[model samples]
Target: MSEQSSQGDDDPGEPLRLSVIVPVWQEAATIQATLQHLASIREAGHQVIVVDGGSDDGTPQLAEPRCDRVLSSGGRGRACQMNAGAEVATGNVLLFLHADTRLPGSTLAALKRFHTSRNAWGRFNVRLSGKRPLFRVIEWFMNRRSWLTGIATGDQALFVRRPVFEALRGFREIPLMEDVELSARLRLVSRPFCVTDPVVTDSRRWEQQGAWRTIFLMWRLRWRYWRGESPESLANAYRSDVRNAQEP
Candidate 1:
């Protein structure tokens, strides 16, 4: 479906129209439930575009029925696929969501309340979708860190006014740390809204890799990246770690 056909006229009192763009790779494990949760926002008149990065796992097939449009991104990177989705988006605002994440039920209404201001970008706080006691502490730190730094992870559902996004030229095409790079640029223009309401992200990665180990690795990667290490090196190291985790 096209954006124009899906959109309604601007009601001065109504929320700004939103286009939620999700970039999916081999995410069949979680895509369906994520789409089902997003369906409410689409029903409320927002556009949901899912960009598939050549997922051999039939992600696009599953997403096509639930989304406004599911496009084959013909690429393998999240930044590339998300930029492709943003290209065809026709709403006043854009939201980049991860397929493993679920937004708050009241998110659209909350976005409506916040987007009316001069503030151009923001993100939701995030909760990891697992029952482990440590997940709560992780969630608190994630929210607090973002509050202090104005940087957002993809799991947080980063959103921005279309114009601001265009000005920044979207996420840089990189193998990793694209969210961090974009957040650094965005903060120069405006302070992020840092909505306290949280989006829930799948914690399977942490569970698979062991929570403490994953946390330590992530901090090490961030520290290196901030110290100007190349993303290619970081991505290679990350892939190696995940591969090792899956080996035995």
Candidate 2:
């Protein structure tokens, strides 16, 4: 995984073809809608791949007809599933999308701009799907922080050139913070192309756990991660916190 490789020098004059990779696990209720929302991208000749993490909820069945390909990851974990999707991706650029996130109409145009730029990777600004003023503030901070730090989260709809992604060997197979870890590595290779067009991500987690509490928990987890805590431990704590929040 040599970051110095000249793979990013691929001909910029060539048209950019995007491959949207969505990793899912037991998302039967929302998978169809997510795939349907990408209809325009597919119609534009871009490829869509759904990698299911052994979803027994028939997510694969529903996604198969809507996308270009549906692959079974044979296990869970977004890092692994997304890596699997990237393995079969045929486009020059790969965009990792969340099952609950919706890209704006200007997504393709933004991607085209990124392809012509010097950047090898990028992410879209994110907007949470909640009407509350607090959600607006949260999204503003998220977008701003990412712009300043060059680190992106999965919810932001991360995209990268296929060669750059392969050079980095995809994401680390960690229990948590995989996106953060990958962003840190990518920043060393090249500054991220921050697109202003926002991707609307579902605010279900914040709404379910109480926005304030979720904010506090996430900040605490990130602080610990920056302090060199193990991802496995952080993942356990996150799961415990979420379970407690769900308790009646």
Candidate 3:
């Protein structure tokens, strides 16, 4: 590495060895609370990175104080936003968390502990935030199935060694299914750990779309992908539903 590159690599300071990178787009509604939650779990050598994907809703400003740095990336998709965050992250490990998700402080500690002991990357149990029985059923089944099968999603908050992540060339900069695509790639190297602690994800999408419709579409998408169909089609369906559901 050149001198300038070496200096840049060595100068991130000690407080940012493990960083939590949150990607946001129009998430002004929950960014502060999310950062506040992250800050409450203060640990040395940990930093929070908020990569705002051109949000016009003031989400970036809301994330400013609680995070170490806020970058404005010109991406209209999660894959690009998160990849941008990873590009600027100074940590040895990266945790890709969604803005609508919340993890208990203990789980963050568990991730660091697991990263240290097993010499493996990480994932978390997935729990949905809502009283819908379908949410409970899906969350439980998915968590247990992941435990048995090692499949994971971005909503579960994937963690990995910085070099391993970079070596894989990072997440595919697709419009959707980035998590599933990345998970499929990660499976080639090692099985993802299903942490006992879970990350709670908001379920406003389920509320907007009927539970059965949402679940059916998700299953159809998964089944299609598993049947060797291209994931891009399923991703397009998912984004369509998401856009329609989020609209007034």
lDDT of 1 by residue, 1-248 (tens): 00001123434664588999999988787788888999888888889999999989988898889999998878889999999999999888999998888888879877776566656788888999999999999999988888888898888999988999999999999999999999999989888876677888989999999999899889999999999999999999999988888896
Error of model 2, residue 105, in angstroms: 0.4
**What is the clash count for each candidate, in the order shown?**
0, 0, 0
Instruction: Give lDDT tens digits, candidate 2, residues 154-185.
Output: 99999999999999999999989999999999
Provide the lowest-lDDT 10-residue window in model 3: 1-10
lDDT of 3: 0.76
TM-score, structure 3 vs. true? 0.86
lDDT on C-alpha atoms for all candidate structures = 0.87, 0.92, 0.76
- State which candidate, 2 or 3, has the greater lDDT: 2
Instruction: Give the alpha carbon lDDT tens digit for every residue of 1-248 in model 3.
Output: 00000011223233326778898989888888888878854445477898888899998888897898898777777888788889988888788999889986576556545554433466888788998677889888777766666667888898877888899998988765688788878777776655666789888867778777787887788788788776667777887877876678
Q: Which sequence of candidate numbers ranks them by TM-score, best first?
A: 2, 1, 3
RMSD score of candidate 3 (Å): 7.5
